[model samples]
Target: DAGVTQSPTHLIKTRGQQVTLRCSPKSGHDTVSWYQQALGQGPQFIFQYYEEEERQRGNFPDRFSGHQFPNYSSELNVNALLLGDSALYLCASSFWQGYQPQHFGDGTRLSIL
Candidate 1:
């Protein structure tokens, strides 16, 4: 089965600009969660989407937003990006939900210039 997928394995952007990353959840998953992973650090949850609505949010600011499509795909949008926003954007999904172990894609490596 097709697993989670992300686009633009690497990207470069400047400060104050905006960037949008894409993700496709694993087969049979209904929930999508976005996360940010800094160099050498664990993934930090940004938010989660279920039923086309954001179900949970993390410590990130409002500038970080996301959406989940009916096909179980997801997208992460970061506006007014900053140098600090440079990190790996990851999308993970679970089969049953309720905090189950999620499978991760390699991620989109975003770099702020």
Candidate 2:
């Protein structure tokens, strides 16, 4: 039983570029959520996907987007990246219920230069 997995554990990009990060959810999980964690700060919710549709969103800008595939894997995309976007991008998954605790993957550390 594998837990959630995220690829390209680290990334380097320049301003105005776009980047995509991938995630594979744990077994028996159906919902995927993206979060951004700045240095020394807690995670900030970006968005969530369930059943191939976006089910909830946070206060992030439209440049932040995500997709949930039929197999429960997910991807997070950021466009027009800014230097401030440098942070850890995390992917979390849980059962479709509202109160379930989410399981997180080792995040992708994104650095914008």
Candidate 3:
């Protein structure tokens, strides 16, 4: 079965450009959650989408937002990116709520250049 997938495995951008990262959920799964992991840090929840609605959000600012399509794929959009925003964008898929241990992809390594 196809597992969770992310695009542009690595990216380098300036300090003030908008970026969009993509993800496709695992086979037969319906939930997607986005996380930001800074260098040497644990993953921080950005937001989660289920049933085409944003079910939960983290402490991030408005610049961080996401959308989940009916097909169970998702995208993370970041506007006016900052140098500190550079991190590994991880996409995880679960069968349902946060109670389950999620399966994660290697993630897209975003670097602010």
Candidate that would win on lDDT:
2
Instruction: Between candidates 2 and 3, name the one with more favorable lDDT.
Output: 2
Cα lDDT of model 2 by residue, 1-113, tens digit: 99999999999999999999999998999999999999999999999999999999999999998888999999999999999999999999999977999999999999999
* Residue runs of model 3 more than 4 Å from their true location after superposition: none
Global fold similarity of model 2 (TM-score): 0.98
TM-score of 3: 0.95
The better-scoring model by TM-score among 1 and 2 is 2
- Model 1 stretches astray by more than 4 angstroms: 96-99
lDDT of 1 at 91: 92
Task: Tell me which residue pairs clash in candidate 1.
Answer: none
Displacement of the residue 7 alpha carbon in candidate 3, Å: 0.6
**Cα deviation of 113, candidate 3, in Å:** 1.8
lDDT of 1 by residue, 1-113 (tens): 98889997999999999999998888989888989999999999999988889989999999999888988888999999999999999999876447688888889999999
User: Any runs in candidate 2 off by more than 4 Å, and if so which?
Assistant: none
Rank by lDDT, highest first: 2, 3, 1
Work out how many backbone clashes candidate 2 has. Answer: 0
* Full-model lDDT, candidate 2: 0.95
- Global lDDT of each model? 0.91, 0.95, 0.93
